[model samples]
Target: MKRMFTLLALVWAGSSMGADWQVTQSDSISAYVLCHQGDCPVRTAKVFDLPVAVPMPARVSDSAAKPVTMHSSTSVRFALASARLSQTEKAKLKAFLKRHRDARRFLVVGSTDQIGKKRFNETLAYKRGMAVAVFMRANGIPNRNIKVDSRCCIEHPPSTNPDARRAVISINE
Candidate 1:
């Protein structure tokens, strides 16, 4: 009879406090405990983003690639003393224009090393900047929407930075 009374007391204690509250607790605690040795697979969740406002193309083409979302600033590099765009740089510029088709304006600022004659460096910078501008025109941007800035050349001390012979492209959306 004494043992039965003790068992009854225990049951009453549990009934008054915490039998159901624990069942509703998160399973993440147990999952976390299972990862003590870092072998457990982590759970993942999918994310959804808001939609974009891309306009319809003026011409329908079956061969045109889909447009991807990309950055607002990019730099296309050139060889030393050269104003020409390499095939890789051409691809980069093409992809950039594709991604930012709705941009209002584009700025191409050309830069060159300070080791050349001031007039020659400025001329090379202008040619580099204009090359990018011309590419933009070919890709459908109007001449009014593109501005080439060549004043960025030979103004600063020369450095080994690879971007010294590059055209920086910035977009105004």
Candidate 2:
């Protein structure tokens, strides 16, 4: 029994000395014995020390992992030429914004009909954009999160037809 116990002990020690391990990305940061060298035990190593550790390193297969996607806020489209917001539209939009205020960043774009001249359209668009942004700001939205852009006559051509100047509000999460 004593001989048997001694034999088992020797076998255990030998097997532990030859423990099979791979210097994976995790192991590269630590030290462990590798199976490649029959009798060599690797000591503590920095990631730079191992030459084989980085050769054609394992590629992260996008397909193998679950696709990571970020959620985006739905875009709100409103008619700019209209003078006023209908009651239902205002209520619904206000409620939605109230719920999403924490994560929303807004962009208000104002456009004008190509009625007078290019310069006139540009001025109108700028004012409309500013108006929309100010309106939103008045409605509990912060000024910091809002961006205003104008597309005057560039977007609207009076030659095409008579159209009202417009403003649009967009939100991003």
Candidate that scores best on TM-score: 1
Window of ten residues with lowest summed lDDT in model 2? 69-78
Candidate-wise lDDT, in order: 0.77, 0.61
How would you encode candidate 1's per-residue C-alpha lDDT over 1-173 as one tens digit per residue?
A: 99689656765665575432122236554211212223434545758896997998797666667665444899898888898999999999999889888888898998887767889988998899999998889989999999889754554544656557889999854
lDDT of 2 by residue, 50-88 (tens): 456556867786767864443433222234443344555
In model 1, where do residues sit more than 4 Å from their true spots?
A: 1-71, 152-159
The 10-residue segment of model 1 with minimum total lDDT is 29-38
- List clash counts for every candidate, in order: 0, 1
Evaluate residue 5 in candidate 1 and report its C-alpha lDDT on the 0 to 100 scale: 91
Global local distance difference test of model 1: 0.77
